[model samples]
Target chain A: MSGFSATLGHRSYEFADLRVLLAKATPLRSGDVLAGIAAGSAEERVAAQLCLADVPLERFLTDMVVPWEDDAVTRLILERHDPVAFASVRALTVGELRDWLLDYDTDAAALSAVAAGLTPEMVAAVSKLMGNQDLILVASKCAVVTAFRSTIGLPGRMAVRLQPNHPTDDLRGVAASIVDGLLYGCGDAVIGVNPVSDSPARCRELLDLLDGLIHEYAIPTQGCVLAHLTTTLRCMDRGAPVDLVFQSIAGTEATNRSFGITLELLAEAHAAARELGRGTVGEQAMYFETGQGSSLSAGAHHGVDQQTLEARAYGVARAFDPLLVNSVVGFIGPEYLATGKQVIRAGLEDHFCGKVLGLPMGCDVCYTNHMDVDQDDMDSLLTLLAVAGCNFVIAVPGADDVMLGYQSLSFHDAQYARQVLGLRPAPEFEDWLTGQGLLGTDGRLVMPPARHALLADPSGRPSSALPPG
Target chain B: MIPDEWSALRAMTPARIALGRAGSSTPTRARLAFALDHARARGAVNEPFAVADIARELARRSGPAVLSVRSAVRDRDEYLLNPALGGRLDDASRAEVDAAAGHPGTAPDLVVVLGDGLSAGAVNDQGVAVALAVGDAMGERGWAVGPFVIVRNGRVAVGDEIGARLGARFVVVLIGERPGLGATRSLGAYVTLDPRPGRTDAERNCISNIRPGGTSVADGATRIVELLTRARAAGTTGVALNP
Candidate 1:
């Protein structure tokens, strides 16, 4: 139990232990060790009591710290270091910071950094760092030693939907990036690039735009650039929905409607791609984004009640299901926040239904801020994360070629020294690679980094010339 | 051009599609069947202890393989109430998949199962693709897979008895879905690492639906090898961390 000296002499109370913090406070039993605060008001009194005895309050409340000895000192430190997330936490020493990280999850460097004093600006930077909302920091690579490896022939290939007139910058960029990344990472496993534009003519324009890239770096596998999907079409059959918009309370229906229109248009565009014989045509779908029930109100918003964005998601998910067969499933982003209680309940249902039914949930989008996601956010998201049985991530190496090259294989902190910038091998599974004795003379693994380095410098550099440790 | 079934589908109007930069695709029952048969023929798994066979054996030997996984992986009450897991076994299930499957190394030429068969409609829709992919992969790799039976069940072990009967090395079971509120009738592939019936998740690998939200066929195929290889070493799947 913890309490602050808010009384200057207001009310003095004591607490026994904290496990019952969530429970309403009661009068202290004579010999029972209890903690409470003497405050100006009832809420203040409760808040002050919570601040005493160095209670692990961050795990409890973010806005309820009281002014007391440690609370006062902690608040001062928090003011200095910038503890803005939880109002309850004003200050933390190095040890406290470590404790916070341990509680928040230490595997994430950003979380640890935030515990050390992060600014709001840093939070924004982190969210924009990756394109995928799939599982964070996840990627895997494998070697394809033989030709014609067992690759299933899906009905189509990786498709990018383009607007009617021309391929928009977003479409082209996202498509090309996905293609390039896959090509580089998966190696010889990816097929050709395709597009899904609105109309037949528009689809043709998209292809025309890709003429150069198509000719320059085309794979032998068949692909498409489809368009002209005016009528709603089915996959393999007609009963299937092309899209699904499961929703909760409505908030900003405008955005939801817009998204719906855009998806319908997407269906049309896919039809165009198919008509055009583009291996890459339109086949997109999404799930609802909700935080509440399927009401028209701001039902699905988060914390501010919910992610007002969820209603929009639900609206969208409900629109294109069983109606159109093309699976355009997507997760609602940054809206609803299932609280701890909600998380447990949801987890129970998720586990029960998941085990009982084979229909596993798919796809989720996360909008991470620079300061690292609040601990509560992680708990809320876990409910959904657990639903996606497997990870389907978009590999984003960003623009740092060296980082990309390094990521092309794998590297850890210890391997950082061997890198010497862009000179060594960065093969993933370095442990296995080294064990297999597949390394450069410098004891590095064989990878694109080494090859790229050789291309730049044929002659070896002097060890003495290099910066000394 | 649209396939005849699509054009004639009860609900949808066959929309015109483009050939775009890539050529166009024409659909026909014959084409669909051919496509599926082609892929399956290509995947004839002659190698004993094929992934499918292992998955089936696990279910036969274990109390309930896929059901156990479904119990933990779902969030919704409906899905939890009727959970589904792919029905093939892997290398690890060998220790437990009914004494017959719980043995070591390769065993049958085929193993078939059902579970939400890919997603219920897969048998009717893209079943061809799954069949083709497996058959083609096995065949090209010098294995022989039969034109086997596909079932509609919550679990995928429906085909196991057949595998044991034929003395096949593998059994490829496909199941129908429990009907997702939104995306019902989708399909996925689960390959057991060992050809056993009593095995668990550690003994299998999955190749989910061909839809956008699911794992791509190509990606799924690649992971299957590693899954098979690892399950061969570990004897389990799912939560049993893969090395």
Candidate 2:
């Protein structure tokens, strides 16, 4: 038994070499490739042996890359670390992996990395292969929620948003989603509406309905109809309660103008709302939304990069001292981001930038269908944001923003985050939930007696939660 | 045969209605002219208003003193994204307006605010000229108008806060309207009674398309006086007071 003094320095093997290795090299035969690398002139052997992995690539790569003489090379190899790990994950049948992961319970970062490493097509394939139970088990295993100190608007607490959007301000559809969200233990932080109509009268109706619900149910949440500042101002003037002055903010003047918003206008709106005592819970009375691609979309980037422009938007939001500042990263579409990889990277960048700027940063972990993304992509981004101490995520029904036509986290998704990550709703909201007997001691919903009445009717009629129009 | 009607209409207005066609498409010349106008419109929206320069220009031109103020929007980017912000004065601008309220005998019946609404080109082109005509008309009417304030990055509602803060009964904000292909430099005068924040657009009377080609500067200024007089007397501007 002659031991070869192998000092492999290369970072990766060639694909053709890998293909050949996969076709011919058994575990025993894989040792032959390793031995070849160990012999004199290991670089050439390593290059050729990168092929012929009849053995699992993970096993093969780990064997080859981990023992490199240079630590830098080892780290570089680790950077491409997913292939080996992925190969191992790929080796398990859906049932086998699901059962194993259910009881696995370790640092979820690795599982997330594996999930992230798989392509959307691959993830879709896995989903199709797995039973419903197994798929859920795997998802729970993949969520990694680290305890983050600073929170969104409130300090040191995780918050969840309930976004009940309606195209025509239909009270029934709006109430149903709200009811659904509340049943899923949401809306303690903010129960805001995304209104398609820019009409002040329509907005007033939406605001009135939301305000009515908040009081009627004693739901501990702030409500806002994210209409234009002018409309919200009208709502206040008409003696309707304006909970939050919402605006889509941007970094540059031209872009902000494109959205029909200006910081000065926001100040005026804030002043109007504050004068009316709308934001009684906190000093800040505004909710601002921003994203990376808006400046570019509005043709107002001013030659600055998207991320820097996004940070500048945070600067604008901070200047207003807003209660909620959301960065809807991938909602813009593929013309700006082009792919989920880009979207995921941009989401992380925006979140980090907002957090650094001391913003109560919540990411709209979302993507439109036109963009190259899937549920798995959102999950990867969501898990990472949760780990990074994101304040809250938007919860629409079925992961679909029906009005905005974008895909975002659903209430069930929030449940998954809470259950698997040991996270809970915002503290004040949690207390209200517990006191109301909506949430149990174990951080799950207690099956409200009025659940059936509150949920949306299949006939598209208003549920019992819908107040008299 | 080339239509004589289109040429006649083209002679009358800059509107695209008179554009002649080449086999179901606009003629090459007409298309090029449309493209040129579109470019001008784009340029008008993108151009930055030099607030101090406009103030200097207005002050140098004569009549009332020009006081420079700004909307809550800090810069061009902010001014664009948040129209609500553009509708109110920033703290510094508010302080300036507030300080002006103490300027004895300067509290006039009308407060004129010159704003770069959507087109800086329009403000640069005709804002000062229009303000002068409006001032001359108000002077003849014996209405004591306050010093002119050039509001940088302002919307229609921006004048409300300026007027309220200045202790004026009326505010005449001459802002640039969103530019159209045929009219890149159209200026509009928005008149409000008892001006303050949260005044709806319907509460204001707007005189739009003030330009060399549209409403002449003198005509616009004259119409503003008419609206102002009616607004003050009627205690309203938009629906309640028809000028």
Candidate 3:
């Protein structure tokens, strides 16, 4: 392979390999700096971008960032390439691909037709060259929808994952938050809970709780207990009502090892969830969460940049035919992202890459307290992602997750996004809300009386009697 | 006014829920409450641990000698940025541990390390109380307990090196967990058997959320002692020994 080089009037820049060029061209983020692969100077970074823009898109297919022999993700991307779809844009350079994506002539059908041919490396490379608006506009044109109990990623639609976590995994505590979210018209994506304990018994209990609520209320949504794959598998074997098998995956095999998972293990879990056949609208039954810094956090980045590694994770998600995939963007602290600007940029980039790779991508727009971020930054990212047509986002009560120790979007925030953008929840969920008198004519929540059926106890009585509204 | 039904739901959990909306957003009171909690948790992350005061308290309550040590990280900023640096002792602290181990006639059965992890306030609030309780429990069992080593800006793995240097059969690290919006001063205890430098989190057992509103300090200490005893009997910790 030939070295990549670019020049200005006074100075010239050179990168030794494709990996080096890709890392140097990436937008400035703390993860690259921590990995010692980021460009040292601003001018050097621009020059690398210039050099990368001229590289042929075909070069990505020929040269892998992580070797195919060492990483299963690389093999998955290469082996699954669709030559017929690639014939449309196979001749374009990386810069040309960016222009092609942003062109008004490139409609949703055009992008969708070529989605199977575009590799993660090709998508991540083009994303590095585009601005945030370009990322949004391109992603907004592409549509990747999945369905289970609720349909997600449909045009003019959005969804929320109601996360009602408690310090001790208390049932009533979780139920209270669920009521709050339901009142605000959230939880269409999935009513998922991150259990404090990963024990199979606790997971089974949470799963049963969510299953009982969904069945009793006849809500048009799925229930998920966000536990380890092994733990979820154990619960499945014991006859638990498993809706979606959740796991955190990474780009490299070693990072997946650090998470105590492998491709084969994920495949097994995916097959088991499908075997249960629990979907009403569709059968996509896996939920995957990925982020930029997880590979580096596990000491398994293989000298690759975080953004590319994040894109590689989408390759893993696409293989499972997952119902939902999201990047918990700012949950990892400032060591990798460092600032709000970095977090916002990473959120856009991850969304664009995942959508282009033919996956129903969402985002957990969150930040740890220790990061230099606040709710305002979260608000900015949330609105941008909404405009970018994110399928769903996590909605915790008041945006404060007491058990996970992070701040995410609140139920009100999800409502605000839907109302402002003229988007509605999944059609089935919206119809159910209308039937329950919880949605007004304008598609806004109607605030049913204090004795709403959603608040009824499992025994068909009001759980708490309160004054009428 | 906050609705009666919303307020009724707040009693179920410490989680911030049922805050009535203000124009499709969180009400001002709920927003400010969240900000205040976040500020407190962030403050706890940067707050300096009172090592000398904690050491003094441990010495007064426990029979074993108390020693203070520092990790390779020089400040809170570096501690947050470079986590690998916080997992090992500095040169001076390594030498101190070696010298302290030389005077010991026989290897102690267990060593307790108190570390100021992400939340220094957590260790400052409950480190000594838990240490003294664990020491008393081990003493009653007639096991030799080594000196309590208080580590500054240390991670959970730091105890492995300290225990290996002292030639203990087991090591228990009582460290501060990352502060959350609900609990800022929460501590966690990690137990490892046959301590060494290359141990992973999968090879250790953890008991978390040790605070006033969460797990009480006394209960945390008792659980630690029981877990360590189980680890000794099974000759393992982490996933190998069922909780």
In the order shown, the candidates' DockQ scores are 0.01, 0.01, 0.56
Candidate 2 ranges beyond 4 A from true positions: A1-156, A451-463, B1-243
Provide the TM-score of the second chain in candidate 3.
Answer: 0.95
Where does model 3 sit among the CAPRI classes?
A: medium
Candidate 1 residue spans exceeding 4 A from truth: A1-469, B1-106, B125-192, B195-243
Best by TM-score: 3
**Model 3 spans with C-alpha error above 4 angstroms:** A456-469, B1-6, B59-63, B103-105
* Per-residue lDDT of model 1, residues B30-99, tens digit only: 3343235323321221111123443454444433222211212122222222222223332223222344
TM-score for each candidate, following the candidate numbering? 0.26, 0.46, 0.94
List per-model TM-scores for chain B.
0.44, 0.86, 0.95
